[model samples]
Target chain A: MSSVHFDQVYKRYENGHEAMRHVTFQVNRGEFVFITGHSGAGKSTLLKLIMLMERPTRGQIFVDGKNLKSIGSRAMPYFRRSIGVVFQDHQLIPDRTVFDNIALPLIISGYPDKDIGRRVRAALDKVGLLKKENYYPIALSGGEQQRVGIARAVINKPTLLLADEPTGNLDPELSNEIMELFMRFNRAGVTVLIASHDRSLVQALNYRTLQLEHGSLIEEEVVA
Target chain B: MKMASPLDEKAAPSPLPTERHKSFGRGVRNMDVVWRDKINAYLRAHRYELVRSLRTLLSAPFSSVITILVIAIAIFLPIALVIIVNNIQLLGGNWDGRPKMTVYLQLDASENAILTAKQTVLALPGVESVNYIPADQALEEFKRHSGFVDILYELDENPLPAVLVVVPDKIGLSNDGSKVLLRQIETLAIVDSVQYDLGWVHRLNSFMALANRFIVVVTLLFSVGAILVVGNTVRLGIENRRREIIVGKLVGATHSFVRRPFLYLGVWYGLGGGLVAWLMAELGLFALSGPMVELAALYQANFQLQGFGLINSALMLVCSGLLGWLGAWLTVAHHLDEIEPL
Candidate 1:
């Protein structure tokens, strides 16, 4: 059973540049998938389309069976709460502490205070930074900051998780560690899709990978 | 397992892949619990949002004070005028002119009869006092006021008649006591006629009424100006927090969520202004109270300065809150659309 569906998706910027052309794919429920391509290969654009950050210019997207076109602006928040996103820059609110950053999604979704505290601590525990709850993002290393972003994304227990080059600024070992964290979530039945152009990190995972070139999907490969 | 084409799937994913079905008996109760919990959680979030907004306002003490002081001074101008006008009306009532009867005596009348008449007039019921003005003094007063001293000096004898001005102890309940007194004084044997000009009295009354109307109109205009002042302040506040609003929108916050903080900031401004206006009005009245009482005593009038009544005070507070909310809403409606999560 698929969790996300993109059919012949195309994205064109206001300046007439088409970031995505005839792109199509699916991430089944409980499936772990990687989207790998060179810079400007439409990887981030695809993740954005899935997150509803950017609407498709000429295509349909179905997340959890609801067509993206049908979701109005007023209902977008409720829809977004069901899917978590982790950005490459670890776009955490700078002034907020680690605990507050992880608790933001749940707060937006209106979780109770006790429930928020429990869930936030649990998420921090998962990211292996339970003791850093009181610390701000600025005080953490790049890898630790990305971990907070990942923890925030999964804090809501969303059905689908999407990350856009989440480890782009991290070292090789830290990149693998972040990939390991994503696999741990995927193994627990959360659908995961990661967009990255890092060649080496994509190799050891042996997950189903979709490769894009320019603005089109050039190949789909699965390790034997 | 061999890999399949990524685009092979033609159907949309199922929204509920792991569905849980239960008996119908628990449906209503389950729904009740779900709705109650949902409402409770949202209420909790609103609590946090409100506190967060308040903290933001308090964090920037200098700018917040400047905004609030601007609003306060705007509100103070109109309120102070309103209170002053109200007290003046009270003083006007106390100084209102009473009807007076002027009795003209025959030129050839006896001095004894005139003296008896003066005594008789003073003894009359509801007659406060009687002043006997001989013809010579009356001529001098007329000459002084008529601005025609040359023509008045040409008179051989004092042509102005001797007059007795009668002040009533109190005006009648029906306001016709002065007229009845006039009729009684006219029957006096030595009196030639009784003269009382009511035109000047009516003019005085209308003047007071017109002054009140003008003050009320001015107060209303200033009130509207206060609203615009608050609106502009809130607009500037929104501009400063533009980035915070964009970030809030990006994180799946609704328009109201993004606007909540600004609305709170505006309320703080309004409340601060209202309180200052109230205090300024009270202090102004206090400063003037001693002098006002002394001035009213000169005319034997019991006058007191009155601040806003409960109803007026409540209206002022309610109006301030609404003005703030309206200003915030108008600004947010226009600016919120320009910012998008993208």
Candidate 2:
């Protein structure tokens, strides 16, 4: 079954701006997919729609086989608990330490304290930052901050992971490292969908790519 | 195509650890164990949120203290007013200011004639009781109270006259009947003069009633002001944590979860304000007790200052906390919706 399926979805803002137009796509469970587009090519809008942050103006979208239209605002949190999201700026709360940042999702999910500590440590180990649990986000380097963001997203062990320009601020080397980290999670039976404007990076990884232009899905490419 | 919502499907995989644990042995699971875990997790979440919110307030101690003081002062005004009005009413109640007429008699009147006059006054309509004061006893009491012993001794004759203190019935005090009684006493052959001042008692009763109404209005106005004070402070708190709220929402935090800390802040502010206001009012009352006793002594009235009783104090603290909770709930409900992850 498809983890995320968008069928002829359209998103138009209040001021006559259409962010997504007839965007139809599907990402099966355990698949790694990349959304490629220019800055205003509806990349972020697609991710927002999937996260239920914004509703489509037309057509139905499905996540984990449940139609998006059926989910109300009250049910948004419950739905989102099944999915993970990472942002370009790494959205780590400045006041919280790295461990606290990752443990937030678990805390929100009502995990036992002992379980939270053990899972947070495991996530930290998975991100190769186990020793920096006490460090605040401000003390981390750009790449390390992004890694912490990834750790937080995956800590809940969501079936689907969404990232919007996750490597947008990093150098090429750091960006590739972040991509490899996504590949590892994708291999672990978690479906990964990342949106990035980097053409060379998409070409190097050669995953299933969905290209968006003028708020429309123009092409789908699978290299290798 | 029709599709089933994963939420209702038993076949769907549960992402939350708690759900997954419950699904492990869905039919065979021990209900008691599940309930215990649920309660423990619930308690842990509350304990964690409580500490988290308290730290947020303590992180800015100066601002928190200032906000609390503003709330305290706002609530203190009405509380102090209520206490003052209460004391005034207590004094009035104790005085029981029924109408009374003091009749001074001629010094040369015979003792038998004075007794006959007292019996006549007691028999008059609406006259409750009449007590006679002999000339020698009156002179001795005057010397003791007037602080003029030498002057009294220098006079060759005792100039003070015998007196009769007459108390009127409640019905007579309520209307003009008492004045007619006074006039009747004035015409007595043995009486020199009759004095009665019922107007002052009437004025004081009316004034006390007005004070009670005034306190009710003032207390209501100040309670609203206190709630708003807490509301605005919580609103500002929500603004400062706007980014955190947005991030929390993005990560699947429920509205109540995001609202928990701000609500706690409001309760803390209200409770702190209540405690400080209570202290301020009690201390002020304490300081005034000495002066109040002296003032009561001047009037020759025995009275003691009454405080906001134990129940009243407890009621105030609970009310302040609830107001804080209500303010925070309102602010959080309004502001949390405005902040969306998008």
Candidate 3:
């Protein structure tokens, strides 16, 4: 079964500009897909649609084969629990420590105290920030902050991970390191989709890449 | 195939998938968290956030206390006024039983004519009893009772008018029946005039009515003022934590989850203020009781000050709780939206 599918989806802004036009794509279970396009190529718009953050102007989106259009506002939280989202800006709560930021998804998913602690520690350890558990986001470096964001997104062990410009602010070395982390997670049966404009980074990963231009899919290529 | 352990068969701890259903069974689910583990996890994870919010509130204890005191005073003032007015009404002395009317007879009327007039008035509606006094007998009784015996002897002739003391039935004294009887007695030929000072009774009734209306108006004004006071306090609290709130929302905290602590804080403020106000009112009454009793004794009255009753106390507490809740709701509804996760 496909983990995330967008069928003829379109997202038009209020100001008469179409951000995504007739976008159709599917990511298979446990597969890693890269979305590469220019700034206005509707990369973030696509990720937002999958997360149900923005509604499509037309057509349907199926996350784990369930149409998002039919889900009510009350049921949105349940849907959000099945998918994890990581933003380029690394939106970690400044007041909370690294451990707390990672434990957010588990907390929202209602994991038990013991399980949350065990899973949060494990997630932090996976991100190589176990020693900085007590450090707040403000104290962390940019790459470290992004890792914290990634840890929080995956803490609940969601079936799908959606990363929007996960390495946009990192150096090339850190970017490759982050990509390697995503590859490791993908190998462990978590489907991953990343939106980015870094051509070299996309080429280095050699994953299935879908290219968009001016809100429409222009090409699909497999670098390998 | 791997062997399934007995533990695995029974591992499904909950039959219901949703926490909302569990809430119905246990009656103790945190609205923010679904299961006990979730609550514990959230708390353990967000201990810093919780401590920071609490510490920020505690840092300005004096200002918060003053605000709470103002609210308490506002709430207590009207309630105290209500009790005072109620007690005053009770003390004005309900004269339902004693209805006396002094009837003056014509000076030239003969004793037999005066006696007949008294008998006629006594037979009228609501007339319970009557006593007749001849002009000569009246003068003699005035001389003995008024301490004017020497002056009475100096008079050339008896100057006292014959009078009839009329006492009406208890029901007649308080209702329209007594007024009707007064009209009938005035029409008697030998009677000069019939008088009952209804002015005092009328004044008391009007005063009580005015007091009730005043209490209602004052209470309404104070209730609105209480809401504004609490709203302003919550607004300040939100302002202080604006950054924290934005971060919480960005990190996937729902609006209600972010709002719960503020709501609790508001309730706490209200309860504390209400308790303080009740204490202040009770102390004020206790202090005034001594002087009020002494004054009542001077008037040979059995008046006693009534203290705050249970119903009034409960009402005060409820008002406090509502004010707190209302204030928090107003602040949350208005300000929480302004904070965006973006």
Candidate 2, A4: how far from true, in Å? 1.0
TM-scores vs. true structure, each candidate: 0.76, 0.82, 0.75
In model 1, which regions exceed 4 Å deviation? B1-26, B94-243
Model 2 DockQ reads 0.42
Order of all candidates by TM-score, from best down to worst?
A: 2, 1, 3
What is the clash count for each candidate, in the order shown?
Answer: 0, 0, 0
TM-score for candidate 2: 0.82
Best of the candidates, lDDT: 2
Off by over 4 Å in 3: A106-115, B1-56, B93-177, B185-199, B239-255, B297-304, B337-342
Write down the DockQ of candidate 3. Answer: 0.21
User: iRMSD per model?
Assistant: 7.3, 4.6, 6.2
The docking category that best describes candidate 2 is: acceptable
- Residue A13 of model 2 has an lDDT of 96
- Give the best candidate by TM-score: 2
Decreasing lDDT order of the candidates: 2, 3, 1
Candidate 2 structure quality by residue, lDDT tens digits, A1-224:
99899999999999999989998989999999999999999999999999998999998899878898988876677678778898888989898899999998888777877888999999999989999999999999999999999999998898999999999989999998899899999999999999999999998888999999989999999777
Q: What is the lDDT of residue A24 in candidate 1?
A: 86
- Real contacts retained, model 2: 0.52
